[model samples]
Target: MNTTSTNCYLLAIESSCDDTAAAILLNDKVLSNVVATQEIHEQYGGVVPELASRAHQQNIVPVVTAALRQANIDKNELNAIAFTSGPGLLGSLLVGTSFAKSLALGLNIPLIDVNHMQAHILAHFIDEEGYDKPTFPFLAMTISGGHTQIVRVDDYFRMSVIGETIDDAVGEAFDKSAKLLGLPYPGGPLIDQWAAKGNPKAFPFTKPRVDGLNFSFSGLKTQIMYFVQKQVQQNPDFVSQHLADVCASIQYTIVGILMDKLKKAVKQTGINQIAIGGGVSANKGIREALTQAEKNLGWKTFLPKFEYTTDNAGMIGIVGYLKYSQELKDKNNYIDTGIHAQSRLKL
Candidate 1:
């Protein structure tokens, strides 16, 4: 394997959650990214950890094969392997970690450990045609089912969490709220769709009064649950009758809470460039809000391509390529084969 930057072929595996994903990258450019989503958890309304890990075990081989096949590359041609190491289900991470370590050792290549949250932020750096990357000292807000955080990015590896969720993540709030409304699992996108057709101000939900930059969505979730109960008690068919309005109002309040914190973060950090990542960054309402902020508030907001917003191996691959490049400079970017999975890793 050539260690030169020009010929760097990296394989990245992401089994941080229910999605078993694999990607092949030549340097910073993604050649193939494949994700196998687990639909088994839908019936349960949320991801079951045991079920998720089992699914990963089943999907890892075929997913990686597909990724390499689609990239038109052989496994032995890869120069390095990367895997998400933390801030995810331990069982799920273990599956990817073990595979990555075995493959790297078999091929006599370097193994890289990637931080899941950092991958979400650095995903913006993936070499895409029209997408522009954020420079140093930008603020990144990662919103997903398992995590929600505002980070200050100084470099590819240098980041500090300035604010984060005190309770449930924004994606969980969306899914839980959708569940309360009797919607299907992963209800965040459905709420975004309905919000477009309804009046945002139809029903007002109070935002949680968290000081400074930290967030608390648990109270907001409780508020929505109580509001739904009261409404259904008064009128048995209330949700069915006013589903759109309720969804719009809920989305509006959630977006407002995010924006308020972002504004505070900007004021505190004096950095106007705002970049967002994670699964909830796929929300249409949030995208619209960021676009509006660009025009109305003179803020430069970086929104990732939809594919990179979710849990995918392409993000991991980009991070791997970056780390591999840095290793050429510093020689200390490689990880040991004895590295273990971390269920709770911070920035």
Candidate 2:
């Protein structure tokens, strides 16, 4: 039974997937953010969810300690604990959610529930001190490894998915294509690097069949597979020799597909302010596309600098700060240890 109105420091933990991350955010100021990524799973050609969970169990504590140290705060000075509650690996989310709840109960402080994807959008605000922040009624495109969606964000906590994938997500498409090309498990970054050197027009890929603002990447991924299979049949060294070109071709096609829907979302939502978030947003091609859209469509665009585009606990902490400022948090928000992860969540 803790009820206090005093200003406080927020501790945020994130174990939604392969990374175990933690941070300390005071108000809207990010004091420290530390992340521990599980590198062992890379050899498996993709994340093994169970392995990711085991890694979180092994890494959560040290990561949190590092975050607290970076923030220069002792555990006793903390105000409340915040963590991602859903839309991630159930086992992974449980690690952070349960830890946060237990810590809050022990410290007699409040707890905040954070939506991982929403935090990715709000990541734009972390560490920004007294700077201009996006107002209500803006558009956010959350493109990550597992999910791809364009959302209408009317406020920090109030959002709705305007459009999304009918099949594979953009990031998943990237990794899957990379795997076929004999690239590593988390092939998104590999695709980006390879695309940088290759000609984007080298290989042609068809856009999705879905209309309007929604997205579909399954067809494009299939096209790449068949295209590559034919190439390999002719020259077994095709991917090895033309890796850059295939990456360029595939990356270009994917970015083009996203831009098509992004433009429409703006037109239909009638919101000129657009923002891009998530790991895929870190791609240089997407950055260039958004910049072009800004100039061509006369729309205001924001892409968080490359560092903030990926999964990080600082974003969760920032969202926690926003909710705290709005008086919308409670210790009771803590997990019951029976929580689950949702592969998808609205806005």
The candidate maximizing lDDT is 1
In the order shown, the candidates' Cα RMSDs to the true structure are 1.2, 2.4
Candidate 1 stretches greater than 4 Å from native:
3-5, 329-335
lDDT of candidate 2? 0.84
What are the TM-scores, per candidate, against the unseen true structure? 0.98, 0.93
lDDT of 2 by residue, 146-184 (tens): 889998988777888889888889999999999999998
Clashes (candidate 1): 0
> Looking at model 2, which ten-residue stretch has the lowest summed lDDT?
331-340
Model 1 per-residue lDDT tens digits across residues 1-347: 65544578999999999999999998899999999999999999999999999999999999999999999999978888999999899999999999999988888888999999999999999999999999998999999988889999999999999999999999999999999999999899999999888899999999999987999999999999999999999999999999999999999999999999999999899999999999999999999999999898888999999999999999999998888887775534475888889999987
Report the lDDT of model 2 for residue 112.
81
Compared with the true structure, all predictions reach lDDT values of: 0.93, 0.84
* Model 2, residue pairs in steric clash: 87-342
